[model samples]
Target: MTKSKQTEWNFDNTYARLPKSFFSDTNPTPVNSPELAIFNDQLAESLGLNAEALNTEDGAAMFAGNEIPEGASPLAQAYAGHQFGHFTMLGDGRAVLLGEQISPKDERFDIQLKGSGRTPFSRGGDGRAALGPMLREYIISEAMHALGIPTTRSLAVVTTGEPVIRETELPGAILTRVAASHLRVGTFEYAARLGNVEELQVLADYAIKRHYPDIEDNEDRYLSLLEEVIKRQAELIAKWQLVGFIHGVMNTDNVTISGETIDYGPCAFMDTYDPETVFSSIDVQGRYAYGNQPLIGGWNLARFAETLLPLLHENQDHAVELAQEKISDFSNLYQSHWLKGMRAKLGLFNEEKEDEALINDLLSMMKEHRADYTNTFRALTFEKHDDTALFGIPEFTQWHERWHVRLSRQQESKDSVNQLMQNSNPAVIPRNHRVEEALEAAVENGDYSVLGKLLDVLSKPYAHSAEQEEYCAVPKSAAPYQTFCGT
Candidate 1:
């Protein structure tokens, strides 16, 4: 493969340095008539790439699997995960890590391509990605970043000029995914389960240096790293809950050790305030539902702590005890983070002893009236009007009284608080109905303008643009929507 010189990938592959057992050495299978649909020039520049070069044919070739770029050490990572509560061994079934790029800010990010093509880890499945899901990922991941959550950023989306057969024939595409690191809780699980304690230690040390470098000198560094990850996961789920995001899949493998949101399969933001909002078609039991995310996140972290038992202490019994103690802190961490986020959403400048109860009252009213979750917070951005007009429930009047009383006690000006709430709450999300509408337009009519326009609105979610009011509104009753797992 002829590599490009203008793009300096600077592949400092520490994960690749591990035993071959950790990953399968492979290259992306080439695609036909590769075309560039979108490229993130700012992200490329952050990774020290010439934005102009990436827009050229040479860039399209590299991104489309026609050629592997220089300094790229492509491989399929190995790991074990508990999927939907079932423990199993899995790896990078359809994704390849192209290489790592060091940013000008002295941060390292993995440059990977999803749906590039088949590899040993492909597992008898086509390595190609459907255009709808690729675009959905690009949209949601970028929105998560704009919302100030730790998440993988989409670098590019390339068209393969081919069709992939799923439930029906679909346009094929590839996504350039960038992450702080692809290491996950399941990575440590794989090493520990395989009885490679030495390798587990090596992985732990590498993670600490790469992510939690500030705690490297701690005597119990590995355990401290485990604790830090648990705290981050707690805070992350809290943020997701505040924004009404259902991750759809909380598998250990999808949980990034760097604490960034990873996969976007069957994910959806809530329209109505149902505690059990589930969008993933495969989640029949509501295991990964909106209300269950925090519990599932804790479950996933417990599995991670189990993998680090050996490194927590010398004695097996002592290690087990210490690990359990650290894991127990997840609840406190989650509660604190959740309350903080909820407080912000309510535009509460001062935390009172009854703040939790005040927030719960509003949520209960919302749930009873089936009010729109996003719109409720958004409406709160304005003065408390007779929201019963919007909610269409007389009971909401009582809740409004309680909210006004709470607000009157706060010293901050309502305008200032409203301004803060406006920025904190998004006017637009990657709503399932809108995403489906965009996908249908693109697939059925070859129109990407709708998808492009939706992405533009979601990219700056907090900004109020009267031009996008149609996009912000909940879909009409006629536009019924459903989400499906890409499996």
Candidate 2:
């Protein structure tokens, strides 16, 4: 179909050009009297959008599905996933991919309207989303970007002038999410269900061209793609652990092929340095806990490999052996990445044979002392002496001495040590209390200033500011913090 050009959108919808079987041609359900909730102006410009022109009511209308953009071909992607280890059929239930937006710098991104409405995959519930959860995603995703983590970006959130009936009535909102691409492990799983290697090959080719174009000419591009994805995920999960970010839900569907964090449901940053911490109320098994992320990452990759078996090799047993070897390498890759990151966090400019033990010993002390994770790192970054709460512990003091000796062995100057730590460790994070406070103010009081300020601090996570210290403060209560999925 011929379409008019939208100057601001600049959409080049390659995803829609794919086979129709890959997605359902669907449009977002229109909402009543849509209003602009929030817009990421900086992100808009970076995405090569004409931010000024679309920063008004028209933008809200576009995001709220009241007015589809000229270049947009709204559709819901089809995918299946293993939810908490249980295989199930699922897809975009309340979201629609508008199209891929090509930026001026030649970067391609998938622009999607999440919580737009229901589709063929909505299952049996209202395909609507509440404002609070949408705002939470906006805040956390932006925070993740600032923390230098690969994640889906939030372009805008528009409030629908209607109440969504959850347990009780709640204000509705829609999130315009931008991503490297929405191709996930679940997509492969869904394609495998079609019972054809050609179908899977097409999807694999599309993904490789979009994300891993470098590997296209390889003799074994399929296996190479799997290895590349596995490595990306290993590095990605290590970064998550370093920053105390718990994804809460690590189901195969949520695992993106681009290694970018996708869904933000029930996600939060840890407070104290405890390996057993789990905030997702639904994660009763502690499957995706702070310590279990790397394992879950490997598990998810194995699922992805299973879908690619036919493409990997003609002999099923040989393919299994190849996939297993690759999966086995995940642990070493993850450990190497995590250890390297931990070294930077510790200001260890040079590697020591005992570095792993040193890092583990400190972590053990932190857990035993119930010390705040971010603050302890920040204090160590500054080499501050005022943190009696953590430094006062005898076990920690001994650990500090060992770390001091370790630092002493390095030829680098003290300034170098501090610089490395400052660069590696964030001065601020999207602390749970702070996030909740911002969401509460915006959703209940209609006060966005709280949220804006939090974003401002989060934007410069490494640079220390006196104002950032407020956000760095841990929640007063030691009560078990809980997180619930938006759905």
Candidate 3:
């Protein structure tokens, strides 16, 4: 075994101090040959990591599971989740948390290795990850962060110099994942299933201290915690809808209690407007389609609320009533957040009853005309007279007339409204076709230039660049695009 690599990760294994049943202490299984594929220098700096140390061979070893960083206690967390509406036990089958890091400013973050190797939760499959999927996550997750969405950031990707069998053998890789915390709705479910009320309380208290410290002392902190999670998830799904993001899989385990986007398995952003759009190949029923995210988010939160019943109150019926009341808030909360975002996209600062109808009217037209979601919104920012051709359709023209009358009532200057629209509407998103092209080039041809260029363009998703216009174009075909959950 390699000695602990002297890297600059300020490891703090707080989760490890929890009860033994919470996680299994296991080191990441080392690979044959490890090579550094990509390093996120900026992310490393934010984590108070020594960028110079992490870009070296030792860093590759550390990231690849060949050497544990100092002060680390690698473990596979225990959790059960509802996969596709079916309850099942699942855990870190292919990943391990390499402890947490406390930055100079005292912010704590988890450092995890995905696709590192098998663990106690590996079940019956090979716990190996492919290079293409790993790179895909790096690209998409970073793009999400740059687009001002909450998400787990990618720190590095390392080639394992081995092959893993899926449809066929593919190059193995490991992804270094950084997050606020890996505690999920499923984790609470896991504690509940153990039939230990004390354990459930422990997990809830720990979660509150780690994520929602403000309410730790409240008498009804557990209820407050549930409410807080509901709020974050509501706003999160709203943001995803505004940005045309599809999570592909809305499994309970994937819903983080901290409310950051987790598990970029089969996730994708829509190239065109369609309420029925689904990218996950496993989602044949479209349970998590583009338009169904808010609903699914509510469903998942209900599941989370179920696990908290034992701690909610003394009477089971009262607890159920309280939980249902909290869960019922999801729809209205989500709509309010979603409408606010939609208003910003349309450059409306003041809210009127008709504002929602105007926004929906535009969306309805976009769907009917098969308009590019990102581009259509972006096009609205340009001088309307100069690009009247794009919006010249009869339905859009009628809607534009109404929009102008609505705008005339606003007090904000035209330039200010345009600026707000530009900020709300992104110029670039991780289009499925473009992302696939970059992944294929790197996986098949060993060329990373494509990936680098895409990252550069995505890093400034709100900025306009004439040279990067090609990145803004939607897919040519309307055929259903599918994404795989690279298991």
Candidate 4:
């Protein structure tokens, strides 16, 4: 029987009209040889793609940088960013967007391939990615999506059928990344710096139409778009904190206007409940730490607001004041979403005025006791004191008492609340140690079994699985590991 093809990719290139300076018109540097590692059939079908064609030589060739698809306007975008609080000009140095594909839901997603080869923005560096990082992105990004967070999705990963050097020889790879649109806060910042308000407005109008079409009817649509973007980002960062996700590198360029988490470099989930968690090797200062995520997100939005000032109001002073006023809303919006999310995670149904204080107290205790964040919540799902075996440390017993008292106040049935907590709090996260272990097996030993198993476990992170119990455990002290930014 012949496999059915889902060829509904009606291509439309809107961003391509924004002038030459917005991006470099170039195709992905073709790889000499390419091989498919994984293809997201579900995502393919959703994007109205032919899954069978993607498995064929023609589809593989198109995805592997050997050929560009019809109607695909491939290009590397250009922008500037503040990296670790320092300003620098940067662009899609190693990634090329292969046009936008509208899903059956009418959501347009940029189907870009990272490490597709070099472009004008390569900046004297080899425009290639190692297989380990590619697979890491695939696993973690998918895991984030399953966790109900807004994030860029991984559609496919392909091996370059070759090796790339980075600290040693390693197998090279490419990742097909999908996002609402690749436009970032830094994209507007680039045009602002050039004193090109027209270009900035063009980009803003494009974004408004693509993401927030309803806003177009408003007179101050651009300003409203900016505010909406800020609000979305604030909520997104709050979600990251609730889950203990440290982005590691929160550069302006990495802050998407779509508010989806982008660029999975040096990103990690917390094992221990420490606010000042830093996993990215390049993050010398704790700029993108777990606790500081909110502040950093606000800072990034402020940069975006500055970029929009020229288009916000007629007078310069008035625009500045209006922008500042709008930016001030970020903190409150973030806190509101964060507190509500934490309440659900803690299985609190009662709305006390001091609920924020109550939540903070538990976090403080966890920090003092060095409790494993993921396991702490997972154990609570069972609400079994005997299962203190998971906590391992005796000091957690004190915090456990406080948590029980807080739970007692909830009016809901204990069993029902426990079920809600279990669903909200995942038993397993993409732990940094386990992620590195999987990478080592794949890169050093060519063993993908561990990687595949980890992917499967992360797919249903909140589900109770007897066979995958090891994944629910925190890393032993002897096996502690760290993640690095693959810059």
Candidate 5:
């Protein structure tokens, strides 16, 4: 069932053909004894590739960077970022974009190999990734996709049959990541630093063509592009908040122009309904905490606007005024999207003046009682009010009465309300402890059953099946969970 690599690849490398200044020409360094660890056959099929053709040793070699597929021109993109409120140069240090794959449905996607090898931007670190973290990204990204979040997809994870030294020696792996494009806010920042508007204009025109094609011919296209990007970020962050996802690192580099979630490193879903949840071990200051995501999103967009100010208007004063006007809209835009989502999560199809208060009040109660975020929502979705953990409280009893009264105002049937809540609230998430267990079993004993089961349960986050029941059990330990940016 294997086909020639050229025929199945369908690459049209437009990015590689872009101006040479945007990226460094570098192919992935070959690995030793490449072997496939996991292949996403379903994702492959969705991308209009022959799954059987790629589910082979040859495919493993390509994924491992031991064999370059035809039509692939690998390159590392250059960019700069404000990492934790401090400006610095950054780029794809250990990653290389193979090329854009043209799907049967006429959609284009960037097929990049992460952990490929050292690039020009490698700054002083080893250009390699560990097997556990690669697998972790695969699991969490796929889980996020299932939850209806816009995110870069994992095509495969190939073990290099080599070891990488992190804190200790670990098995090496390469992740084949598929994305809309690799353009980030930092990319524009890099372009703006060229000491002239020519490079910046080129980048802006290309970005508008690639992402906001409809706005390409608009008179105020540049400003419109900024607004569109702002709108997408607002909507994207709202989705993240609705699911309780803490990005842990909200640097401008990670804010994609395509508005898709990239870089799964150090990201996790909230277990407890606490807004100040910070999971990254390095985030001692609660800067990128769960509650701070929307604000950070706005800050990142403002940086993007700063890069586009010259293009936004001819006059300096007018451009500053225009940029300020659009950036200010992020607040109302984000609140609209977030409140709408929060309302849906509560099964309130219609808006009311007290909706925000109701939502905030429930969150307050959950925070006070330390209710498991997923479990509390699932309890309400299933109408299990007798569940003592959330329901057996005098304060909550009052909230419950108010909630029911709110529900009575709607004409929607009980079944409809349940359906909305069920769809909005996931029954399971990639719980940190369970994820650790899966990764440990696979990396230590070469047993993938635990990981496979977790993937299966997570693939349908909204489904309340018996398989999900065990996975949904709240964590027994109260110890704070910490995540690492291993990639």
Candidate 6:
């Protein structure tokens, strides 16, 4: 298994220079046969990668783990997470980082392969990813990027001419994920649990330099890092709530210090408005329900803050007090972001004291009537109330009058407000049913047209048109919807 010396990637292995305990050096397991299934040409160009070079057989080999590119020091990162209220040691069981690539614009990104192969952290299971879930992540993550959400993007997907046994035997696949950095809250937790203050301090400084270089000179940089992470997570969750997205797993490891959304397992967008909605089948207790995301975000940040206590202050009690005060600000920060986004959705350009109640009342009515979350907001862009049938209810009609009165008091023009709502509310999301159908067709029948069609519609999320009207409808399934983690 000799490494190949040819590659189009510009590698900078900074993380590899960290302590040996931070990661396990390894190469991706070679698949029996490899074929390139999808390549993001646009993303490739942005990363300064030669897309033409990667679309060939040799490129497929590089992506499928048959050949390690030159300058790649592949490794499995170590982490620990509180999954479903239970803390456990975790790592890159089925994935491997191929080293960092500095883009043409001087931005750094980790090029990792998901479903590449087994690692030391496989934990008695086959560390393989099925084709369906890999493609699912490819579709949803790109869609999220198009919708203006900060998220990890897919560079390519390669199919392995092998089978993985899940609930049944499924075709194996590999996904190349690009991220700003792979630093997570759980990384710090792992260091703290080892009782190595030196390691923790080194990791903290590395994080600040990598992600928050502006705070490197500050004396209270550790405290500032904690505060910045909290603010980012709060705003991230606020955006998720505004878009009706359910992460389904808000565990510590899945929470990135970079503020980018990572790990797209068992994630879905809301079809209908229900504050307590839970989509992950494994979540029997609804611990990560839609309504609880903000609280869970704060809770995860609290865990992150705990790990920084040794570095936050010399006095332990003083550090705890500082952390608590910062954590307390999460609620107000989240509320401000949420209110701003919700107000724009309601076509309100100017803020008013009554805006909160007005927005909440509309959501309450929508929940009471089980209105479609995306459509209900999209409907507000229309001039005639009757044109949007979802608001045909008497309660909505009454609320509509109040909304109109509220709008009249504002000085902004109606056209400008309508434009604001149309921009804030997306007409198309990666609908759960549609996503399932696409995955089934591609994985079961090798039909990719449906998947391409869905991607085309989702790429223009803000564009409301008759052609994409069907995409706006919710599925009429009788059974409750559920999504699996595809472990």
Worst 10 residues of 6 by lDDT: 1-10
| Stretch of 10 with least lDDT, candidate 3 | 383-392
Per-residue lDDT of candidate 1, residues 214-247 (tens digit): 9999998988998899988988999999899999
Q: Give each prediction's root-mean-square deviation over alpha carbons.
A: 1.9, 1.7, 1.8, 2.5, 1.3, 1.9
State the lDDT at 189 in candidate 6. 82
Q: Could you tell which candidate, 3 or 4, scores higher by lDDT?
A: 3
The sequence of per-residue lDDT tens digits that candidate 2 reaches over residues 282-384 is 9999999999899889999999999999999999999999999999999999999999999999998778789999988888878887888889889888878
Residue range with the least summed lDDT across 10 consecutive positions in model 2: 1-10
Badly placed stretches (over 4 Å) of model 4 are 1-8, 386-408, 478-480
Give Cα distance to truth, residue 339, candidate 5, Å.
1.0
Off by over 4 Å in 2: 1-7
**Candidate 3 lDDT, tens digit per residue, 92-156?**
99999999999878999999999988899999968889999999999999999998889999999
lDDT of 6: 0.89
Stretches of model 1 off by over 4 angstroms after superposition: 1-3, 384-394, 478-480
Residue range with the least summed lDDT across 10 consecutive positions in model 1? 383-392
> Which residue pairs show collisions in model 6?
none
Point to the candidate with the largest lDDT.
3
> For each predicted model, how many residue pairs clash, with residues at least 3 apart or on different chains?
0, 0, 0, 0, 0, 0
- Taking the tens digit of each residue's C-alpha lDDT, what string does model 6 give over 1-487? 2223233588889999999888999789999989988888989889888888788888899899888888889999998989987888888999999998888899999999999889998898788999998999999999999888889999989999999999999999999999998999989888888899999999999999999999999989999999889888888999999999999998999999999999999999987789899999899999999999999999999999999999988899999999999999999999999999998898887789999998889888878877788877877777545434444688787888899999999898988888898899998999999999999989899888899899889989998877789998777775788999999
Candidate 4 positional error at 461, Å: 1.5
**How many clashing residue pairs are found in candidate 3?**
0
Q: For residue 332, what is the lDDT in candidate 3?
A: 100
